[model samples]
Target: MSSSIPPSVKPGGHTPHDHDDAEHLKALGYASEFKRDMSAWANFSLGFTYLSPVVGVYTLFAYALATGGPPMIWSFLLVGLGQFTVALVFSEVVAQFPVAGGVYPWARRLWGRRYAWMTGWVYLVALLVTIASVVYGAGPYIASTLGFEANVNTTIMCALGLLALATVINLLGTKVLAVAAMVGFTAEIVGALAVGVWLLITHREHSLGVLFDSFGTGTGGGYLWVFAAAALIGVYQYYGFEACGDVAEEVPDPGRLIPKAMRRTIYIGGAAATFVCLALVLSVSDIPAVISGEDPDPVSTVLNDAFGATGAKVVLGIVLLSFLSCAMSLQAAASRLAYSYGRDGMIIGSALLRRFSPTRRVPPYALILAAVVPAAIVIGSKISTDAITKIISFAALGIYIGFQMVVVAALRARLKGWVPSGKYTLGRWGLPVNVAALIYGIVAIVNMAWPRTPDAPWYDNWIVALSGLVVIGAGLVYMIVHPLHDRSSGPYADAVPENRTKA
Candidate 1:
């Protein structure tokens, strides 16, 4: 019993939707275009594009500031290790059911379809809200680069322009998205390396003493908890890696390539992200200044200081590439996630939203719809960039919930001795890794949700709370609708659950 269809009278037939998926898979190159040769690199690059700078710059700064000084660097390293364990668990689920829906489908099989629909609806709500966050997150960087005036209109216009560009890029499909990510990957690596070099060469006087000694600058008492929570907020950047798995059907060799691509992405992209984290910690003279409210572009400030405005410009270019790459990557993932939802009949206009372009083999309708939601948020421009950062942080937080659910399901199977087949393996380390991922997730979520104090009205707390409400609302709607439409095979299907791999 997969997640997509509820446990009731199961309907089996050669429906048009079935034919459509098979053909859609063929047209998109998932049927053949995605050979193992390129999948690993492309997926890793995609993951890097999404995780490297977007989430990194926005929330991690809060973590560094709220936590200690350079010790924040170690927080990220800890989070990364925990996330890696979760990623491995997901890889096995993916390898078992290498379809487009990913975890929701797994939920259907293990839990039941009614539950799966509720969960998928929750995921869809998270996805749509995240679109708004991305636009909000990137707006300030573009605005602050040349140092825009006090004119709010000018800032609004500049942010709008970024949204327009990202939306357009998204319309072009994953082939274009992948190419842009590759470019982003190049810029990200080069920029981080360049920044690291400049920091070491010029800011040599800063030293480890400053890095280590700067932690106690904040108010004492529950400060350690606040700091950890804030860092968890920052760690959200590395999310969306699972997007690669969701769009597995659109790739070339899903069974052989999708899991491989996903795992390799964790390995490679994780390394790059670690470098960026380490560079920022090592480079800045004043740790608090970077993530603090002052400098909008902390890394750029370091570059500008190290090599002058020219150097800052160089880093700015990289950050822009990083943001755009992330936007493009996000657009692809969001669209694919929508398509997966449609396949499960969760969204309105499911048939239309899930339509594939006959020529390109891509989900043009879903992608187009995906762009509209985010662009509309950007158009309003009411949500501050910091607010958007919180949203992505919250999105990362939501993903952990999904991770925990899957881990519980997998662990349940393990306890029952009902082992499944898949590509990702945890060796003798499975139980320990699962426990660690759970702990890491719980810590990050608490860190993310913790308010600045008892009276603060921080956007992170608000957006996260609102997003949770949206999930609840979606579940209620899904439940009402399911009773009317269900021909259930279970309560949930892991997400249109059929097993992980078709090959």
Candidate 2:
């Protein structure tokens, strides 16, 4: 699990932990610029918070239930399994290249700079839009709980406010971000458990078998298609586990710790989300009515039915906290991505974006850029309220696109005789799992991005697919016009650690 330190940077006066971390980083061709303030728990908390069950489930719950009925709940387990496969590949990659840029860095090391740039570009956009989506999702819940009119202006303002709060937390440095994430994690767990238990005990209205019942309302290529669309909720929820890898530089012994943090984030987050979804499904009073639009907002309706306005409001408040925490983690992850790209002089204004504040040991400019793009997205979403759904879909699709690029890269690397190193390894099962992960990523991307709304305009139906193409196309154009010298092959080539031959 430990990387060999290059003789030049070997520990003399530095503590063993700091020396190990510093040398590990130096061998990877980066300075220990920021404070490695996050512990393993904080690392896991950031990932868990980024994959916030409250935000993901509550935001998309009604859509899934309406689109695919009760059976859609099973999509959580299915997507969780698929994503776990991807997580396995990512864990192995991160163990060796435990740097700031998550998918981007992994892709670059495995493939090259052009591939990494695109992965970073798609992921950066996804993370930014995700911040906007999380904040916008929080608005109505916040408004309803606080008795404010949940209008466009109010929602936009609320989103902006939350984005601002997240920005401030990121600006405060790793310790504060870690603390906020931990608090958010604790709150979400407690709140999910409290509401889930209450609902199951007092309001259970359906059999456990209901989750398998499709209710015979299949459309748009029958049950599987509807199920695929419903899987968006699960797909979105299962991601952000890589946020642990994104902030790997901030974690001590990242090669060993980050992989564990990533897996734990998925396991714990997936379980909590499933429990909540199950309780909500079993608590539904009338599934037919919910699917028929009689209860357009089944999640809120169920909460209000189980516990009066006051109780619902309390739960909504916890959900709002979850939303904010999710935004905070998204911004932090995105900023690290920016910093990573900028560090190698890959992006424009690399000097400023890569600069770490001496006092706070944070990338202030990168944080600002992260907040700015999402704030712009929020502003745009407000202009067309209907755009919120499409934007969220597109964002999730972008993330998957970036993820599969890494999966594809891993497969290519494996075929080229690459071997994984560090504490974690799939061993003989690696090829099958990698191939399965690759297949799942491709299938999921097509399923999620395929136009489900045939009646809608072409652009509306194809927003996810179109957005992904545009992002990738734009990145390509930019790269062609302003090509980057591959850092990994240049003077700054990462030193090959003596013990790191397995990679």
Candidate 3:
């Protein structure tokens, strides 16, 4: 696949492989706008950076430890395997479609326009919220690293600054975005591995056996419920792998390479997350205090102990990069989804959103939409200290919902006799993998959205599930108000293809 496109071609330059990619897009009823500059590594880097292990583990370490104790680390393995199944299912679908806007395109090609609209709307909102959540999460670390007091005002400002930086990088073009992602991936992996190894060799405070010891943390439904709540760490770390397919047109031979990138993102990102979590878990100096809520930020507590103040600040810098990279990749994905919707005439501002920058080969209007909404979300955080958290509570669940929509659509297509015709196909294992993906996605969604916070206000407790319902409900109401017509000239414009086996 690498040999298909020559490395000598200049940025935005055309070649034989470019013509091939264009032909593929034309066959799918769309003209190519993105420059095919992202290589397999760049594509994988986008997904890996979005699924940043350092960002995920550091942000949620204290919460997971406090909620479920040491045993919560197991959720990484469980959720990793579960999400990998979803990745496999996605791999198959992306191989067949290889279209922009990952879940939305897959869902549209597999189902119909209304279904695609809802899926894209939900996923686009989720990506925007996730960008806000990531940069917001980065604020405290930024504040602490810069020797400033971490407060609501400071955090909000820091979040806005990071969001602006990420947006600028994204606006630069595909090459810049890929470079930023690759740099982020490199820094995060090196930092995580260095920290993990150092902690294991010199800062080991607990034995491997401690992983099984929950330290008596669960209440109503035994440890299982608490474990489910704690599973947010792994759940949040996994889904960004699909971002690779979000820019399917930006990579040559995406049907083959995108699936490989998705699988690699899952395998490599999962391993990095588990290693980081395991090291952090074993290095916690006061597990009992963490479980009892006395040590609120165990990641900081462990890092400060292991590396001291100066060294910890350096690690924090790396974490800040991971957060920024994650936000940038997410914004890129969101913009692509917006662009895809616009291209298909599925959204209100189709013309503006679909307008591509001739020089940059990017959807400038869509990128602005991605950045503006998330910035507004960050600004809205000033209304309440927990506003960002409430918004973020919806991010993981929203993503899971979007993912399952695609999974369900794929299964429905399969039952309707659609066979995947692509370079990569599951063949005999397709049915079982699709079924497993659906089952796992449903269970994970239920687990993620379950009202687990009993002592909090009713609304706070149900925020995750409620937020998801609100988004989906809003989309449903809009579709009903403006009942969708087959305005799109795209291949599958509100109509499933008669030949299910053809791509």
Candidate 4:
């Protein structure tokens, strides 16, 4: 009854029902065994594409359109640069502890079980909350999909529906998830290009001057740096690529696969998204009108304004589909990350979490649990979409926190002369690179904290208030109550499962 054995054993050992839930992924010809199928490009694509549609197009850019105005394109670049710093740090840590568990495993191995457990809780809960937020955000797009009014109620229902589909897909295993990732990645690339094309075609007379014109400080009464910093919020747009790294073990040749995926995801996604932002900025004829619209959807605003009614509708359909694919990828990622953390005794429900869909080599119970996280947000967004937004945005802070932990580990390792000293390094004074990355993470968290322009139709701060406390508090409680608390510090091994949670 080793909880860590093959991760296929049931409670009593008489062989349980086959995990039929995971077969869809395998049927798509993804590697069945954990650590067998995924590549770095695949993972990177998953994270890259996941963020563009869901956060960039649907969420962050919309925030800019509603708050910062056309200048949001600059914000996109800033955030991208900031997160790029974090990605470098990941390159260091992922090389050493190149396991499937990601930061949770890396933290556990580098520090110890207690801190690792805490990190695991933070990552697990944060991802689910993120999935929730995406669902909350994507619901409207879904409503728009079927030509529904996309009101709060309709959006919530659509989001929940997406969550259901994603849950089923993830439970089917990493292969289907990978396939979806690939499909989603393609969709995002095409979607962004399509939007850009529509913008150019319609706004033939659009001004190229706005691209270089700095707008924020001109009116916000700040220096270029201040406005540039403020604009960086749009930069947070290009995350969620690291989700592929979470399922590292599920992919074949994980070490090589994850890094490749991670790098490609950043480069391609960064380039593609940056192109979209530039296109959006240059292609629009009336910046103020789109920004000030009653429903200021950035992508739609740009496309519709630049093109005509027809062009706008076409772009809208693409954005809608992109969000659906995004929802699917995010849910699958959250589920796998939860399963990985739980199966490794880094979270609660170790016993239940260790059970994989025998037929599909996936974690069904974990996916089921993950579905609820987003579904709840979808429901909450019905009452207060702002709550959903704030909570999820704050959860992003936790993600950066977990990542920084790994970054710190990498620094300490370098100080102690660790192997694999960054074949993928930032090179020529790496310390500055690390420092820049660290500084970016710290700064971005502060910016995301400001409520200068985030107020939305759903009037409430419950998402930020409750989510921050609940998720972080849950992690702390588990760390305090579990036998793996710091006081129990001792040598451990990959095979050991001490202080496993009953839940």
Candidate 5:
């Protein structure tokens, strides 16, 4: 991978490679608007920052431990293997399509405009909600670092501030975004490694045998059901790899480089997440209390105990940076998806959303939309304390559903005899991998969306599945009334060379 660098294209000057990339875009029925500036390392950094193991592990450690005991840590490996298959399928699609929007363009070129519209709609909502969730998760760390009280009001305020900050960085264009991602990736890796090693070396409270012991957790249905509920820790950590392909127009040699970046994001991010989880599990001072729900925040307890107040504060600072970087990367991906929708005239306010700032080489209005929608969602936290949790629950489910839609579309195209013709092809492995991805995606979506909180109100229990259905149903109604799919100008499945003239 090349080193992270600034935008390579200069005013009135373009490299031959840049011209070739633009020609490829033209062949796909779109003129290149974004500057091809992000290098291979920058692309990987973007996805890595979005995956952000520090952010994911820190956010959900307490909940997972409380619900499923130490054994829940294995979910990382299970979900990692499943998601790797999905990444392989996506890498091949992106290698062939290499469009601005990740799943939307892939689905559109594989199926039709209608399928792409709904898939994009669901994925866009998920990204916006995820941004809100990440920023809100950072609230406690921000409050602790700044010596402020961590309350609902404080969380909302901090989330809004973080949203605004991320929006500004995104508005500056892809170069600044890439640089920030690189910095975040570096901080996350170093901080995670240092913290994990320190905990394992100086704060080993339990032996490795604890991972096999559940500490009498789980419900009447047994540990299997509870383990599925706790799998969110791993399910949430494996995505954001697709963000590498979301900015396809900004990267050179995307057909080859983006696939490598996506695979790297999954392999490296999964390993980091597993290591961090293992370290924390081994360092927990009171596993029984955590599983029994007596101690609500094991993460804070472990950190404060291992590293004194001063050291914990330093680690909190790193956690805050991870959240900011994750939120920023989500915003970048969301804006590009929105821009792709508008560019095809498949959404409301197409002109405004598709408006590109040539100077910055970004979709400014789209960036604002991404920030504004998530900010609105953050404000909704005032309605109920569980609002953020519900949003997060749906965020993971919605992402998996959107992903499966693309997987199914790809499988359908393959059945119709369409073969991937990009530089990066799975070759004979394509069919089996695509099949495995679809099956895993389906099972994961069901596991994530299933109602498990029987003690809570019905709405809270069903929030994950309900929220996804609501979004998809709303999109269906909009598609019927506005007929945006019919008005779309983007190329469809029939336009591909494999479909029209044979591979």
Candidate 6:
């Protein structure tokens, strides 16, 4: 049942041509209920917007510079390569499975319901936290661009407001979301190239050699530890490309298209991020001032220095566009995850969570639930900055954990004689590629879980690792208490009876 070519797929294996997606869904025990309106470009746009380089690079640029100096920019190349291996593994799995819920469904089909349940549980909560983190990150940028005070209260309000807007767009259905994603994608690409070129040409404060310098201030093995910490910027930015696969059910010719979209997501997102980060570093008029907290708003300060206050506001406005697109993509992916879990009766109140909006053809309740958690987190941010930061910091770690589970499962299946099929196949290269992916994933997880601040309290220092363990443990308890064996067992148990293959 578990292999690159699952028995649920057509007997002959992957066809070079577009096979009947509906028939494939039927073979897997599902119906063509979703509106498969997403084009291949729109699909790619989701991943690109989710991995919004502008949002991630800009938000983390100052932190990276302060922690590891100009050399930190190179971590994008390092981490991007590592993450690309992970993306390769994901692209193969998604091509074969091409179902909703992404990693969760793929895990169930490749492993089993138990593994899938835990994967779904952990991944779902992780995605919720991701939404909170992204929205909160957007708040300050949006506030500054709009002339707000940019205080905690204002940031929280702005985050909540943005969250609501994203939720509403998701409720309108994938078409609206897709259009918004395309717009966001265009803005991000233009913004990255324009700003990077402008900074590099007109305002180059540092030479290219500066990127190789070891400039970090910490009481440890020096720049090595600092570089490792800064690598998380790449980790956080490169993910969410799987968002394309998460909503595969809504995309046309998913078997042929989703895999391509996933790869393109990495290529485009990575290049854009690398360019912008390099530009930001080169444009820093005063690196020491930024590190010392004198120039608190590094991104804005750099922009203003390069192109005055008016120009800075215009560029910040583009940044806000990227944030809006990011939130939309995050919520859209999250809702699909919720819907997929609900569709399989994998969560509480399966009836409501799985229901599609009569007119919109989207999961309204699921979208609502997705919006609610992040909003609550935003409210909590108002009460305690430290608490909110701890929770949000888990975003990258949580996502990487979910990703590694899929990679590990893929590796296990490959070792058991799984050969990847579908339009995109690694063929003889599959084994080594998969092995490399597993290694990178394991290393990345450990790196993320490693205690960065030894002097901080245990909870503060080990929150990322602990949050992952606690969530997985809680999932185990939930499964034991609720028990999903009856609904999830066997090849056809969770499939719609009408869509079941006639033996």
Candidate 6 C-alpha lDDT tens digits along 204-322: 98898888865545547766788888777787778868899988888878977888898898888999999999998888888878777787779888898898998988898888888
* lDDT, candidate 5, at 434: 94
Candidate 4 global TM-score: 0.81
On residues 1-503, what C-alpha lDDT tens digit does candidate 2 reach at each position? 89776753435533357778888778777776777789899999999999998888887888899889888888889999999999999999998888887988888887777878888999998888888888887887777876889998888888888889999999999999999999999999999999999999999999898988877668546797788888788887899889999988888788889989999988999999999899998998989887888888888889999989888889888998999899999999999999988887887788888888988888999999989888887788657767667666678888888899998888888877778876678899889999999999988898877887789899988888888888888889888887764543422212123223544
Best by lDDT: 5
Q: Considering TM-score, which of the candidate structures 3 and 6 is the better prediction for this target?
A: 3
Q: Give lDDT: candidate 3, residue 302.
A: 82
lDDT tens digits by residue: candidate 1, 236-334 = 755756776766655544555666666666666666666566666666666555546565555555666777876666566667777777767767776
Better candidate number, 4 or 6, judged by lDDT:
6
Local lDDT at 108 for model 2: 82
lDDT tens digits by residue: candidate 3, 1-503: 35444675645666556777788778777888888889899999999998999988888899898889888898888988889889988998888787888999888888987788889889998999988888888888899998989998999899999999999999999999989989999998999999999999999999999999988888656988888888888877787889999999999889889999999998899999999999999999889998888888888888899899999998889889899989999999999999999888887889999999999999999999999998888888889767777887888888999999998998888887777887888999999998999889999988887887789999988999999989999999888887542566666622245643354
Q: Residues 319-395, candidate 4, lDDT per residue (tens digit)?
A: 76566666676666666666656555554576676567777777777778888766876687757765666667666
- The C-alpha lDDT values of all candidates are 0.61, 0.85, 0.88, 0.61, 0.89, 0.82
**C-alpha lDDT (0 to 100) for residue 354 of candidate 2:** 88
Deviation in angstroms for 116 in model 2?
0.8
Error of 2 at 269 (Å): 0.8
Model 2 segments beyond 4 Å from truth?
1-15, 219-221, 387-389, 485-503
Please say which candidate is ahead in TM-score: 5 or 6.
Answer: 5
Clashing pairs in 5: none
Off by over 4 Å in 5: 1-16, 495-503
lDDT of 3: 0.88
